[model samples]
Target: MKIKTGRRVASALGGAALALGITLGTAGTANAWTADWETVDDGHGVGIYNGPSSTSGKHGFHDLYTPDEVYLICWIRGEDIANQGNVWYRTSEVYYYRIGSYNLWGNYYVYGAYVDNYYAFHHRLDECKS
Candidate 1:
């Protein structure tokens, strides 16, 4: 009986240890930037905007993505622009370009509409995975 009790205690301790380890491991990853990373939808193009609004200028990067482009969406802001209530996603990728004589590369915003539109889609980096 003593031996059986000892084995049961050891098994319980092992199970507890495993649960704690899994909880800690997942907690660490929960804080990772990849947790905020989202993929762009297939066949849709998003644009990196100069600002959260659709009226904001488009940076010169102009690289349209086909699909599954991973981007870190730091936050979202609500703005009334482009005749629709827009949810803009702020990202980490920098948009590079030159304005006449000056060169610049910086992070930009993209409108959600661009991500949903069928044609003329500009993959800016705002659309989140569905």
Candidate 2:
């Protein structure tokens, strides 16, 4: 199929825009988060981080990102797909806890952690009065 000149231009522009968006989205400060811990045995264990310590300072001093209404959040970080563990696989239960003197600041983050067998964890329902 022959695309018109205008259509071709628009298509090219759209593709370019999409590519730019993808690049910008992934681009960020290096070491944005602290590698508090990483799996020693192949990616089976897991990697723990206090907060993003990138040059951008994305996570600031918080331990994790609180849900929109103070609820569930992805408070854990893994190296790659191999390390991205879920609430299964007979692994340690990652629980984010408060650390440092930033107690009253909110969003304690994933710290003061250890290891425990976890089956699953999903609390979509929050204490919202909706």
Per-residue alpha-carbon lDDT of candidate 1 for residues 1-130, written as tens digits (9 for 90 to 100): 7544543454344335434543211111111222233435546466666667656777644533443232333335556565655566554342121222221224455555444441112333224332
Models 1 onward score TM values of: 0.42, 0.18
Error (Å) of candidate 1 at residue 14 is 37
Candidate 1, residue 15: lDDT: 38
Worst 10 residues of 2 by lDDT: 29-38
Runs off by more than 4 Å, candidate 2: 1-58, 62-81, 84-100, 104-130
Q: Give a tens-digit lDDT track for model 2, residues 28-106.
A: 2112121111112221222233332112122333323221011122233322233334221111112222232121212
Using TM-score as the measure, which candidate wins? 1
TM-score of 2: 0.18
Stretches off by above 4 angstroms in model 1 are: 1-35, 68-70, 80-84, 94-105, 113-130
Model 2: number of backbone collisions:
9
Compared with the true structure, the alpha-carbon lDDT of candidate 2 equals 0.24
- For each candidate, what is the lDDT? 0.41, 0.24
